[model samples]
Target: MISRLPGLSLPERVWNTARRWAVAWWRILYLGAVVLVLVLSPSSYGKGTRRALARHLYLDTAPVLLGFTVLAALISLVLTRIVVVTALSYGLSRYALEMVIRVLVLELIPLTAALFVAMRCTIPNGAQLSRLRQAGRFDALRSQGSDPVRIELLPRVIAGVFACVTLAALSCVVALVLAYLGVYGFNMAGLSGYTRMFGQVFSPSVTMVFVLKTLFFSLAVALIPMAAGLYDSGERAQPDSELGGLARMFAVLLLIETASLMGNYY
Candidate 1:
């Protein structure tokens, strides 16, 4: 009979309502940010602005790629260890590498790296904006002859996008190496099939689409969290606000993946 009662108490109900409001606001902010990026994209065309933007893109992305390469290498080691141990235990060592590559490199590693940065860096990007908003820094910058959007937010957006691309690429490479070692035991015979599969999975058009999708994912990941942070209204930021930012980031990441999968497979 007691089990028939409501699953949530009054405080929980209030919390849930607040959570819903925060989520809705996050969606609105994400949409707005995307629109803003589209409007500002280089396709709109101004030579000086385009050059500056390109410089920022490369500068921000290069270091991130290097960092991600090292991190992905570490993750690859752990994953390789697990696959090898499991395969030997199960007497299926030959199949282990293929499974590891298929599951880890092609899917999980890139996705996980994207999520890691979205949480680690993107959330802080939003929080920084929130702090700026609270401290009247935007106004001060404007008064002191600065375009806050271009100077502050655009660099961050570029950095986030570069970080995602570099991390994904590095993770993919590391996973491939780990898969090969795990499967072939350092023999050269597996190279032919590995190359064939790699070519098949990474066809030219597919590669282009993957790159574009990663860029979109990076843009959304950075934009949404920052947008949510901007929702603070000078009062103490709500706990639900940051959670909402995270939820939106996850949602956007999934949306980008789904769209990419559909384009590639369907």
Candidate 2:
């Protein structure tokens, strides 16, 4: 009788699974690095590339920004009211404004904006990319002396970044204004106090952490889906791939938020 190969032990199986995960993650990072290099290259900003980028940016940003702004404003208003009322009840009114800024502006808005972009734009774009890959469009473009990534994918990634940053910024501004109104009730007398309070809340270190966290959130929203699509082999349908991308993106966002919270509070 022919000899049979032995089955893997539990440790060997676990090791194999971990190694596969590591290799997959390394490939994703490699793809991100390549995109970053192309983005920074002077030649990547050709006339055609600029036009494509502009189109993608506009499409990704304009339609969703207005809706998200309205929603964010409503949520901010309600949350601000709740916080202000609770602070008054607890005789902690003095700390209400700082709490609002830290919780809503620094934490919630950026995270929400990233998730909004991922749901509205990047996930769908990734699915489309996977479909194109399934149809071998990438290889066809390569055979035509064209770079599919630069021409087709980079713009979506850049636009996703723009959408996340812009949405978060606009929402934060709205939240700050609403917070002031909720706390001080549209009195011009509170303007100086509001400005001072804002400055106090956003110390240099806190500001740095906020900015870095927002940028990382934007990148996670944009890049994870793109990476998933780039590596998807079409063994699964588009919806399944999108679901996996969403899970991965959520995990990364959670990690980023956890780190930001530690940096800010600890």
Who wins the TM-score comparison?
2
Q: List the residue pairs that clash in candidate 1.
A: none
- Per residue, candidate 1 scores C-alpha lDDT tens digits across 1-266 of 01122577877667766665656665556656664775477543356445655765665566456676777777777887898799899998866665666556656666776777776676777788778877988889799976666655665666676777778877787778866775666789989987887777678877776777777777777677767766553334224367766776787778888887787778
lDDT for 25 in candidate 1 is: 64
Worst 10 residues of 1 by lDDT: 231-240
lDDT of each: 0.69, 0.85
lDDT of 2 by residue, 1-266 (tens): 11122586767667654554555567568878988998899888888889999998999999998999999999899998888889999999988888888899999999999999999998888878878887999999899988988887898899999999999999999998888888778688889988999999899999999999999999889888888787853323222345656766898899999999999999
Off by over 4 Å in 2: 1-16, 233-240
Count of backbone collisions within predicted model 2? 0
TM-score of each: 0.68, 0.91
Clashes of each: 0, 0
Model 2 TM-score is 0.91
